[model samples]
Target: MATKNVVVDLTKREKLDGTNFDMWHRKIQYLLNEQEVLETLTIVMMRPENGNTAQHRYDLETYESWVKKDHCARFTMLSSMHNDLIGEFENYPNAQEMWNQLKISYGGTSATILRALTLKFEKYVMDSKHSMAEHLRTMSTLIRDLKAASNNLSNEQ
Candidate 1:
């Protein structure tokens, strides 16, 4: 099991004596430098607790370890992609619109996989971040979009 522990210097968030924003930024820079070293390894898994819960599977703790070691850019990348997934959901005004979009974008098992990925992303953001309730609300909105999309697909079929 290849595992890495991470240390974060959140001086800006830390209530320490003489700690300023500049110090915090500098500390973040150092953290980024360290993270660059870690990304050298292959990302065998994105999330620890994935769709499968087999004997060979690892938990979210494994994924979080990487997240902790990840640089600011990496964190931002995850955030941006998550937002994009939701945005894609929201782009459709109604179920009909969603069905049309999904029809063009995916087919068969691929469609199922794509929807599952979007839903999983919602779960991932809600689980990993501190503000659970708020994230849940966001997930709720996503769920509505997903449901609407499904309805549209059914109507078309």
Candidate 2:
């Protein structure tokens, strides 16, 4: 089988600092999906214990493929994160563990965070001194954060 050479360019994207997890998560997930390695974030493949058989050889190949993909996924993830965050995640044995730990650390919203986000969204006002584009961008960011915190907004909101 011919292997596909995927080039991931994360230079244009913002590194995952503590404050931008939602946007970083969305971008990284899309990158991993495009690389066809997103499954490595959730699935763990094991090497076959038995040897010298056709099934063992096939399983070994499958496991190898998984390893290759897992490495790519892990590298892409690490490359997209900030330097300060890398040390916390670099030692994970597999992409799945790293991904899970990230989700647990940054994905889960505590009640206090949710409330703060909601209040910010509700009280936001467009500043007359700022350009409309800047105001819109700020509003969109607030909306994204609120959604990430599991606070759904209606069209009228």
Candidate 3:
């Protein structure tokens, strides 16, 4: 059997501070998926009981595969987090639990944050002095922020 080796370069990526969970979550998800390890964040594999049977050996191989993938996924997540946040998450026993804990801690958009994002989008005006590229980049960021805050706007808007 052939194994796939994936090399991901995260040096250019932004670390996940407490304030950037939405963007960080998306990037981490993409990286995990690319490595074919994203399922480790959602599924738990049980270790097969020790036995002499061939079936047990096959099960052990499957379990070990899960463990390897889980470790990769967990490491990738921790590497992308800020130093301050890493200490809080590094001790999790598995990627699934760590992912759940992160969501519970930072995934929700509060009413105030949502409102602020909406207001910012509504109030943004392109300054003619800036280049069109700059204006487009600012607008794109505002749109992304609003969407991440759960204020989903239609493309027609």
lDDT winner among the candidates? 2
Worst 10 residues of 3 by lDDT: 1-10
In candidate 1, the residue pairs with backbone N, CA or C atoms under 3 Å apart (3 or more residues apart, or in different chains) clash, namely: none
Q: Which residue runs of candidate 3 sit more than 4 Å off their true CA positions?
A: 1-11, 111-139, 150-157
- Roughly what TM-score does model 1 have, to 2 decimal places? 0.22
Q: Rank the candidates by TM-score, best first.
A: 3, 2, 1
User: lDDT-based ranking, best first?
Assistant: 2, 3, 1
Residue 7 lDDT (model 1): 37
What is the C-alpha lDDT profile of model 2 across 76-117, one tens digit per residue?
888878899999999999999998899888887878767777
- Look at candidate 3 and tell me the lDDT of residue 52: 88
* CA lDDT of every candidate: 0.41, 0.83, 0.82
Q: How high is each candidate's TM-score?
A: 0.22, 0.71, 0.72
Can you write out model 3's per-residue Cα lDDT over 1-157, one digit (the tens) per residue?
1112222345245677665678778878887898889999889998998898999999999999999999989988888887889999999999999999999887887776677677777888989898999999988987887777778897666
